[model samples]
Target: MEKLFELSHQNPALFVDILESIKDAIFISDHEGTTLWLNSASEAMCGVPKNKITGRNVRDLEKEGLFKPSVLRMALEEGKNVSTVQTVGEGRKYIATGHLVKNKEGKVIAAVAHLRDITDAVKNTSKLQEIEELLEKYSAQIRKLTSTKTNINGVENVKLGGKSNSRILAKKIIEKIAAVDTTALIVGETGTGKSLAAEKIHLLSKRRNGPFVQINCASLPESLLESELFGYEKGSFTGATSKGKTGLIKAAEAGTLFLDEIGEVPLHLQTKILHFLQSKTYMPIGAREPRNADVRIIAATNRDLEQMVEEGTFRSDLFYRLNILTVKIPSLRESRDDIEDLATYFLNMFNEKYNKNKRFSNEVLKKLIQYSWPGNIRELENLIERLVILSEDEFIEEKDLPQKMVEQHMSSNSPYISDRGTMTEILEEMEKKMIIDALEKENSTRKAAKFLGVSQSLLMRRIKKYNIQLVVEESKTFVK
Candidate 1:
């Protein structure tokens, strides 16, 4: 038994070193289901250093919540190779293949497995739905293992507003995924709550107790952003302070670091960020040694990174790294059903904030739903805040809305055909009403048809279709 398990390290074929050099995680366990070895890649992807669990039993690792439905255990039980997609390392997706290792006498001596991290590969939007379903299914096992956060009705501190299907669906997805440490890429138009979504994911995570550091890539020049994200050493530059500064990555240790406007990041910095994503290690500027930070990354971008990659503006590698889990927050116009709910929520929020008792009039609510919010949620919230502060009356009425918004509402929801009917029926109804009104004025068919700009015969046909009487008793409809 000792001789069979010794080949990995004592055979001198350098199999252990070979596995360590490969990027995919590799694990080996003896026939008794005891862990024999785990390579460096396995240690990193599994989020457990080799020193912590070397020579430990596989059951202990499972009990410690290292990974779920162990492929190695399954392989040992079935006495054959097993393949599966498992959730590991705080909810990361991996493609795992476990094989039964045999001795020279054809006896099963150990179990070996290779795990490829597929967190980012499966995140392409075209494959996103299928991947999400897969993650959700496997994540159930993981959730049982790491149910550390206080959950409310199977959700966490996700505060996404609005009751539209799109909004609600988006919030539900975010809550389900918030417990994991996977990198999330939020794609939406500017001011569409991309940052808010990122924050919610962090707040709902196990790292909620840690800081939520955010840095906008577009807000600073390339030179300054590098220092801000990766930190700089003392005397690294002319204006360097006596005390060295910590990077956002370092500052957000064991927490969440949100990179907002990630599409605006320069090419060189993208490479560094990609390196950090891969290894969780970074070298500060002018530093002699690299340091590792245990931080979860959530990046938001409005630009089309794939298009930019085609145009050679954004690096493809970095784009993939950031898009491990993509959440596309829809524009406000796309989620019309949520308008009223969002409006009411904001109304109550602003009322409490400004110590006001203002309310939104029925007309105001109608107008709000009608207007197309090109600027998304941010624009809506800003307008509500302004209305609450500026309105003299207790209610924000139609007049309180901006001119453009009011005109848009009027244009969209005009009173034409307010009742339901086919196009031809509506035209006939209008024709009948016009003919009746004109006839009451002139009391003659020729003058009525003339005022209607139609032949008398056509007006007569429409009148028959609408069943409107020609009586002039009170200038109103009296069917005959």
Candidate 2:
């Protein structure tokens, strides 16, 4: 109240000391946007010394990456108060407010920008968003569980809980195909959960309340399969029951009939299966009339029916009919991110079954992930059950692993588990190492591509992406 402007002009050091004592950062700039002066708080917030920024223009400082978007410049250009959130260096955030200083004629001469650190607020906001997202995901899952039509249980839920993009896409595909009542084909490697997929589809479909009858075509002889699938009339053939038998198709009336290993069905029986798919009718042996059944068909196969069709084995027509709504489950090796989750699920399951408290050592689990699961999920499940039953120690260790896995671990150069960085980063490192090994052994890009089972263009792109340095000698490439 003692005329602050006159006091500042009389003793500038007093004003400077007063501004320096303030907690918030204060930056002063002339109307032309050149840095005039700033307090110690501004120097600390900007992570730069006062001398480095004192005489520089705001535009030059912005170009030098001091702080994004000069707030003083904003106040000078807009001729009004301005506020903005700005980022400095790597992770700090600040809320900047700019105000203009005017002369007696109301002409702007200087601009003062105040900055308040809001890095904590921004981090808390990001954390809150993540929590909300997690809540929403759980809410969606709860909704699916409460709805009977969409209720997926047992191994179905476990299979769908994969963190990989492929598994997430398969879950979406299952949900979509379940809504529509139609024939669905499940295709995957022998142990990749094709049967679980089919069962999940049946439970999620409109036929949840009805019986789900399953038959493995590969397990039955042609003569027996034909009789068991279509049923037999009374006194139909030798050894036939006096009373007619109900076939799987008829037993699953108003429900779903899961044909496991449909690709193994005989060519003669393929036509009959195609007929059932087309007309929803089949004839019982020794019956004069065709029997009608209200049942949905869900077929699964590890065999490539299309290739079989080309070889004159599986019927093309039947393959076409079942291929309309297909669900392809990725093998455990192809979806490595899901391996840990699946292994843990199987461990818990076998533990519960055997009434034992057992867990895998960290190294053992890493070896499981590193091993190429040719038998897919089935092999992993069996291995867990075996360990749960046979292992003398409570914790399954690396020594307890199979010989092949231990050999592979010894021969492999890549890390089985990530000590730091994300899964993606760990995978990239593995890929880089493999590429380098291939280049060293093959000594040529084309040969290396063949060894890696990838196209030359793809290998080149990956090499470029990883920034791998290669030394070429007489058309041979070497990783430097």
Off by over 4 Å in 1: 1-158, 239-242, 410-480
Tens-digit lDDT string for candidate 1 (1-480): 566568655767566667778998889889978888888888887776787877888888878778876899888888889999878878888889999989899899999888998878756543655554454454343333322232222224456888888888888878776867788899997668998888788878888888777777876678667767787787565333234566778878888888888988989989999999999999998888999999988898888899999999999988887777888898889998888888888889899999999998888888888877756788789889999999989988888887656655443565474454777675555455456555543456665676567898987887777676665445343333
lDDT of 2: 0.81
Clashing pairs in 2: none
Per-model TM values vs. the true structure: 0.53, 0.53
TM-score of 2: 0.53
The CA lDDT of each predicted structure is: 0.77, 0.81
Clashing pairs in 1: none
Which candidate leads in lDDT?
2
